[model samples]
Target: MRSTSLTTGYDIAILGGGVAGCVLAARLSEDPGRTVCLLEAGKDYGPHQQAWPQKVLNARALPRDDVWERHAAVHRIRARILGGSSCINGCWNTWGSASDHAEWSRAGGPMWTAPAMERFRRAAVEQMGLRAVPDGEFSLWSRAALAAARELGYQEVDMASPDGGPGYGTPLLNSVDGLRWNAAFAYLDAEVRSRPNLSIISGASVDRAAVRAGRVRGVDIVVDGQRETVHADTYVVACGTFGSPAVLMRSGIGPASQLRETGIRTEIDLPGVGAQLVDQPGIFVPLTPTADLNTSLAAKQASGDLYVSRMLIRAASALCPDGSWDLHINPTAGPPLFGRLPPGEYEAGISALLMKPASRGRVRLRSADHADALDIDPAFLSDPAGHDVAAIRSGLEIVQELAASAALKSLAGPAADGHPAQDLSDQELRDRVGTYWHPVGTCAMGTPDDPLAVVDGEARVRGVSNLRVVDASILPTAPAANTQLPVLAIAEMLADSLRG
Candidate 1:
C-alpha cells in the first residue's frame, strides 16, 4: 500500500477524503503547478457506482463490503469512501440560517456569513442544478406543513430562513441526471481524479500530525503494517471534529491533564480541542391522514412519478432547505399497525426541527487510538430553557395545528402514535423530542476569549501553527437546516484562504 516517488511528497496533504477533502483536492489541483496528496482512511468509491442512487434505500448505507462491518461498533455512518458521508447521505441541500453564519462570524469564523455562504452555494448549485417546484409531490409534506402553519396562525417557517434570516425557496439536491451524484462523481470526477498533481491514497489511516518546532511538518500514518511519514507544507485536518481531536490527542497535542492520563507527553494544551459540540433537536408527530400516502408514494415512484413528485416538493419549499434532508408531513400508505392492518389505515408524520440549534456539546477521546470513534456527548437538550427548546416546541405545536387543519382533518383520523391514536400530554411530547443528526462545533472556530472556541475564525487551531481544521468541527453552532451545503461552503472558503 506504500507507493512513493521522490517527487510525490506534495505541497499540501489533506487528511480525510470526504466532501471537504475532495473539494480541496479538486480546487487545489486545478492549479496544475501545485502538488496535492489526498489521503482517505476509507475505501475508494471508484468501484461501486451503484451506491450513488438518489433514494436512501438504493444508496449503500454501509461502507465497503469488506471494511464496513469491522468499524460498525464505532462510527455508525457510512464514511469509508472517497465521497465520505455525502455518498450515502440524504441529498437535502437546504442551506441553514444566515443568523447562524452571523453568529459564526462574531464568534471566530470571520469568512463564514450568509452572503459568503450564499455565494458558495450559488456556485455549487450552478454546477448541480437546483429544482424548486411548488406543486410537486415530493414537497407535499412541506405544503401541508405550511398550510398547518397558516391554520395555526404561526409565522410560516422557510427551510433556510426559519426566522427571516435566509429564505429557502426550493429543495436543492446533489443529483446529476436525476441520480445521486456524490463528491466522488461531482467534484472529484475522472478528470480531477486523473490529475498528476493530485495523488489520492485510499485505505490509509492517519495516526497523528508530525509536529516539529511547533509546526506541522508531516503525518505519522499506519499503512499496511509499519508506520511512515508523509510530509507536506500545509496539513489540513479535515478528518472532522471528532477525528481531528482524536488525532491531535494521539499526537500529544491537547489538554495537558488528559494527555498525562494517557501517559503521553503534551505538545499543546488546547483545552477546547474536543469541546463545544452542537446539534439540532428533532421531534416527530404522527398523523392519520385520509389517504394511504406511503403506498401512493411508492406507486407513483414506480410509475415514473418520482422526478415529478420531487420537482413539485422542490418548488413548494416543503423539502428540507437544500434537499439535504426532508421534513414534510406525509401519510404512511402501508399498514398502520405493525402486527395487523386495519382497513384504510394511513398515517402522515409532521416533524419539528430546530434547524439551527443554539446548544453545544463536546467530543472527547475515549482511547488514544485515532481509529477509535471519539466519545461524543452531543448533549442534546443542553439548554432546555434556551431558545433552542422554544423553536422545537413551537414546531411541535404547529404540527399539531396542521394535523387538526380542515384539509388534513377532512382526510385523516385523529393525530396519534398509531398504536393508540390519542393526544400526547405535554410531558410525553417533551420526552419524545430527539436529534436531527446534525453534529458540529467540537472544534468550533472562535477566539480564545470565547468559552466554546476551538479553532480561530481562520480555521487555524489556536496556539498551533501550520495546522488547520476544515470540516464541520469548526462550525460555531448548528445551522438551521442540513449541514452539508454549509460545510462544503466552509471548505471552499478555507481553500481560498489556503490558496492565498
Candidate 2:
C-alpha cells in the first residue's frame, strides 16, 4: 500500500468508505506511488481501538438503526459507516449464479461473463476471510432445513461455489472468532491502515462532487462542523445506491427537472441518475419452532461460539426455466431481529426474496440540503411483468411447504402469520412484503442512448468525466444471492480497472 502523502491533490478521492470504497482504497494504494483518500460519513475506528462498538463488530447480527432506516413508505436500511452495510449485514458470502452473470455479459458488459467474473469473486471472498462452518457445527435447524429442501428435489451446495447452481446450503460467512469480519477488517486491516498514502477520513459527510467543465475535480465535505474542499486527480463515488445519486444531484448532475425543482442549478441533464431504482422484494415467514429450539440458540449465544444465523436455499423461480436460479430462500435465526433477544425468545423464520426483481423505483432529492433525507420509492412488487410478485410468493410457498415437512416439523412448526402462506392474497402478500435490503440499479449500466442509463458497463457516468459509480447502484440487475458478496466482487473487479 502507498504511504500517506503531504500533498494537496490526491491521485484518487474515493467517496464512501464502505464496502467498495474501503476495498478500492486498500487495493489502489497498492500502487504505492498513487495517493488515495477515502472519505466516510461514519465512525472509522481502528481494529485495536480500546472501544470498538460491539454492535459494529459482533457476529451476532446487524443492528436495525445502523443504517438509514426510512425511505418513502419503505423501511430502508443502508449502512453509513466505514465498513458500510457489510459491517451491519448478515455475513452471507454468496455469489450470483453463472446464468445471472451470463445475462449481464450479454447485456453490453461482455467483460462480466461468468467465467471472467470468477477471478474477482474468488479474490473478494478470500479477502473477506469467508469460510464455511464445519459440518459438526451446523445448527440442527439449519441441517434439518437442508434435509427438507433435499426431499423437495433441491440439492445441497455451498452458496459461494463458482458453479453457483441452485441448491440449499449452509451460508459461508466472513465472520471469524465471533466477530463480523467486515470490509474495513478485510481490506483496511492494521497493515493497510498504518499506510501513509491511504488516509481514511471518517465522520465527514460529503455535500457533493465538485464538478467543473464536465469532469469531477474534487468534493465539498463537512467535517468537524466545518466545510472544506478536497481536490483529487480522479474521483470514485461508491457512496451506495441512494447516496451516489444524491451526491451527483447535489453536485448539479441528475434529472434536470428534478434538480431545478429542488432549487439546484443543473450542470448535467442525465435524467437516469436516479431513475432505475431496482430492489429485491422480500418478507419474513415466521414459524413457531419446536420447544427447546429457543433454548438451544440462547445457550449458544451465551457460549460465545460462532452460531449459524443464516442458511439459504437458492432455487429457480417459477418464471425461470428448469436450469436457471433466481429466488433466495433465506431462513435466518437471529438476523432480522439483529440478535437482540426479547426475554428468552429465539424462534427463527424464513426471508424469501426475488433475486431478480422487475419492479423499478426512484431516488431523488427531496431538498437541496445534503443533510436532508432523499425521497426513495422502491415500488416493489409493482413489476409490470408480475415477476417479483410471482417469484417471492412462490418462494414463500416453498417456505410454507418446507416448514410443514416432517424434517423441519421436528425442528419448527407451521407458519405463524395471520393467514396460511397458501391462503395469502396478492394484496396481502404486498402488504406483508418488506425489502431484502439489496437495492441496486439506481445508476444502471447501459449505453448513453438508453434513457435510464446513468452509467455504462465501464462504470462511468454517462455524461460525466473522471467520475464513476462502483457500488450496488451500478448492478444492471440484482444478483442471485446476498448483496455483500456481489458488491465486494464488483469492487474487486473495479479495482483492476482503476488500477490498470
Candidate 3:
C-alpha cells in the first residue's frame, strides 16, 4: 500500500475502495495530471499476494475473516477488505442475459445495450484473467451433474456469453490454481500502484459528503480515530449496494421522512436511494451421498482438486420471460459451507436459486453513525403476487428431477424423510431460504422524470453536481447471474464515462 497524507486535495476522490473503486482509480489515474485518491474502510493488504491472509487468498472456500460483522446473519456477510466482496466471494464470474441488458438500457440508456457493453465486458475478463474451468478441476460430482443435465435434454452453452439461452455449463473463474485473484490484484497491480498521482488510503470510514446547494464541496471521513475533510473537484461514491445508500442518506440524500427519523437534514429527497433492494434467493435440498461418492470426493480433496460446485444449470421457470432463464440449479458436493462433517464425509446438495425475482427490499439507516449497522430487509419471496415463490417452486420441481436422475441417484440418494422442496408451503420455503449473495438496485439509475431514480443515465446524482455513483447500487435490477463479472464490466464502462 502506498502511503499518502489525506490533508491534500485531489482531482477525483473515490469513496469505498472496493471492486468498482479500484477500477475507477486505475483508469482515471492514467493521465499523469489527474490526481486520484481511493479510500477504503477496510485494510489494504498492499499489492502483494504474500501479504494477504491465507483464508482470503484461498479460493476453495468462502473466507469469513475480514468481513464487516463476525457471526452475523448469512445475508449480511459482506467483505470489508480493500478488494471488497471479491476478496471473500466464490471467485465465480458469469454474465447476465440479453433481457438483463434490455432492462438496464431502459433504466439507464443505450450505453447499457449488450452490443455497447461487450467491449467493456471483454476488457474486464482480460484484466481479471478470468478463465474457463479446466478439465482436471472437474470432480466426480461435477461430472455426474453435467451428465445428469445432459440427460435432462439441456444443451451446453457458453455461460460467460450474454447471447446464450437456457443451458448447463461452467462459469469463468477468477481463481488460478486454488488462489483467489481478487479485484485488488487485477486492477491495482504493481504498475498501477506505482503511479505518483494515485493514492490508496485504507481504514478510512466516510461519514458524509459536505453538500451545499446540490454540490459536494468536500467529504468528511474518519481515519485513525480522527475526523477530517478531504476536498476534491469530483466525488464518486462506489460503496456498493448497501453501503452506498447509507452514505447518501447520511449526506442527506434519501427519503425525507427516513432521513428526518435519523435526525439528518435532507439535502436531496431521493426516495430511491435505499429502496428497490433486490437479491437472488434460493433453497438447498440436502442429499445423502453414498459411500462411493464420499470416497471419490475425499480423494479429490486430498489431491487439492475438490471444488464445491463447478457447473450450474440455467433453467427457466413457467413464469419466466420467453427465451430467458429465471433459475440457477447448482449441484454441489464438498466440505460444508458452515460446519465440518466427520472425516471423509462431505455435504452434497442441489440448490435452486430464483434469479429474476420481482420482490423488492430496502436499506434504512438506524442512526446517523457510520459505524452503526444499517437496517436491511431482503424481503425474499415477499412479492404480494407470490410470483417469486411460485418461481422457486417451479425450480424445485427441476431439482427433484435432477436428483432422481439415474446418473445422480447412483452417487447420492435422497435424504431420509426429506420433504420435497416443491411441496413446501410458502412459509416453510421462506424459513429455509438463503441468498446467492448477488444484491443490487438500491441506488437505481433512470431518467430524471422517475422519482425513484437516484442517479441519471451517466451515473451522476439526480440533484447533486460533480457527484456520481458507479457500482452495483446503480443497477436498476439484479442480473440473471453472479454480480462479480457484471459489476466489473459496469465499472469498466463507467470509467470511460468518467474520463470523458
Candidate 4:
C-alpha cells in the first residue's frame, strides 16, 4: 500500500472510508511509494464494532452511540463509520448473476461484466480471509425451504461461479469467529490504520468534493465543529451512492439546472450524477414453527447444532462452486413484531431476501446544506419500466410456495404477512414488497453518449478529470442476491485498475 507524506500533500485522496474506500485505501497503499490519504466522515471502529460478531446482534446494537451508528439515518440505511455499511450490514457475502454483469457491460459499464469482475472477486474474497464451503448450515426450516424449491423443479445450487455460468451457492460471510466482519475489521482496521502513509480522519462530515477547472482537487470538511480543507493530486470519491452524488452536486459538479437553482455554480454538466438509483424491495413472510426451537442462554451454550450448522454451511461452500443464495437459517425465538426481534426470540421464522434485485431507482438532492438529508427516491415499487414490481412479486410467490410445502409444513406452519403478501393482488404485491436496504446506482456506468451515465467502466467521472467513483453507485443494475460480495468485487477491480 502507498504511504502519504506527513506534509498533508498526497498522491491520492480517498473520500468515504467505508467498505469501498477502505479496500481502495488498503490496495492503493500496497505501493508504499505514493502517499494516500483516506478521509472518513464518520469515526473509527471502536469497542462497539469489536463487540458484536453476529450480524443480528450488530444490527440490533448499531443504532446506539457507536461510531458506526453516527452515520446512520432514520430513513437512510447503512452505517457511517470507517467500515461504512458493511460494519452494520448482515454479513451475507453473496454474488449475483453473470447475466446481471453482462447486462451491465451492455449497458455501458464493461468492467463490471462477469469476466472482468472475476479477477477482482478472486483477489477480494481470497485475500479477505474468507473461503467458499460445500455444505451450508441451514435451520430445519431453511433446509425444508430449499427442499421445497427442489421439489418444484428449481435446481438448488450455491450462487458461486461454476463452469463459468451464473452460479448460486451459500453466501461467503465476512466473519472470523462467529462474529460480524466488515471492511474496517477485514482490511482497514488493522492494515491501513497501522500505515504511516494512510491517515483515517473520522467524525468529519464532507460537505462536498472540492472542484476546480472541471477536476476534483480536494474536499471541504467539517471536523469537530471546525472547517478544514485537504488536497491531493488524484481524488477518488468513495462516499457511497447517496453521499457521492450529494457531494458532487454541492461542489457544482452535477446537473446544471439543479446546481443553479440552489445558488450553487455548475462545475460540470453531468445530469446523471444522482440519477438511476437501484435497491432491493424487502418483504418478510412469517410462519409459525411446528416445534419450539427458541434459544435460551443455556440452550445456546448446550446446542452443538449451531456450530455444526455453520460448519456444514462452510463445507457446502467448499464443495459447491455454483453460488446459490447463502442461507442464515436459524431457530427464531419468535416472529418479528415490527420487522425486528430480540436476539433469540423468533421461533423458527426465516428472513428471506432476493440476493440480487433487478430493480433500479434514483437519488436526488432535496437541498444544498450539508446537514440537510438528500431525498432518496429509491423507487422501490416505482421502477421506471416496472421490472422491479414483477421480480419482487415473483420472489413473494416463491416464498409462499416454500412456506406451503410439505417439508416446511412439517416444521413451520402456513405463511402470513400483515402487509398482505398473500391477500394483496399481484399488482399490490408489486407495489408493497419494499427495499432490502441495498441501494445502488445514481452514478451509472454508460458510454459518453448515454445521458444518464455518470461514470464509465473504469470509474472515471464523465466529463471530469482526476475524479472517480468506486462504490455501489456505479452498478447499472442490482444483482440477483445480497450486495456485499459484489461491492467487494467492485472495490477490487477499481483498485487493480488504479494499480495498472
Candidate number achieving the greatest TM-score relative to the actual structure? 3
Give Cα distance to truth, residue 213, candidate 2, Å: 1.9
lDDT of 1 at 117: 58
Worst 10 residues of 1 by lDDT: 308-317
- Badly placed stretches (over 4 Å) of model 3 are 1-3
Highest lDDT scorer: 3
TM-score of each: 0.81, 0.93, 0.99, 0.83
Task: Identify the runs in model 1 with alpha carbons over 4 angstroms from their true place.
Answer: 1-8, 47-78, 133-169, 176-178, 289-295, 304-347, 384-387, 415-431
Model 4 ranges with Cα > 4 A deviation: 1-7, 46-75, 108-110, 132-137, 162-168, 189-191, 293-360, 415-420, 426-432
Number of residue pairs clashing in candidate 4, backbone atoms closer than 3 angstroms, sequence gap of 3 or more or interchain: 68
On a 0 to 1 TM-score scale, where does candidate 2 land against the true structure? 0.93
Report the lDDT tens digits of candidate 3 across residue range 1-500: 44456768899999998899988999999989999999999999999999999999999999998988999889888879899988999999888899999999998999999999999999999999999999988999999999999999999988899987899999999999999999999999999999999999898999999889989999999989999888899999999999999999999999999999999999999999999899999999999999999999999999998999999999999999899998999999999998899999999999999999999999999999999998999999999999999999999999999999989999998887777778889999999999999999999999868889999878999889999999999999899999999999999999999898
- Superposition error at 318 for model 1 (Å): 22
Clashing pairs in 3: none
Model 2 global lDDT (CA atoms, 0 to 1): 0.79
lDDT of model 4 at residue 226? Answer: 79
Against the true structure, candidate 1 has what lDDT? Answer: 0.61
lDDT values, one for every candidate: 0.61, 0.79, 0.93, 0.63
Q: Which of candidates 2 and 4 reaches a greater TM-score?
A: 2
Query: What is the lDDT for 85 in model 4?
Result: 78
Q: Give the TM-score of candidate 1.
A: 0.81
Taking the tens digit of each residue's C-alpha lDDT, what string does model 2 give over 415-439? 5655676577778888888887788
- Sliding window of 10 residues with minimal summed lDDT for model 4: 311-320
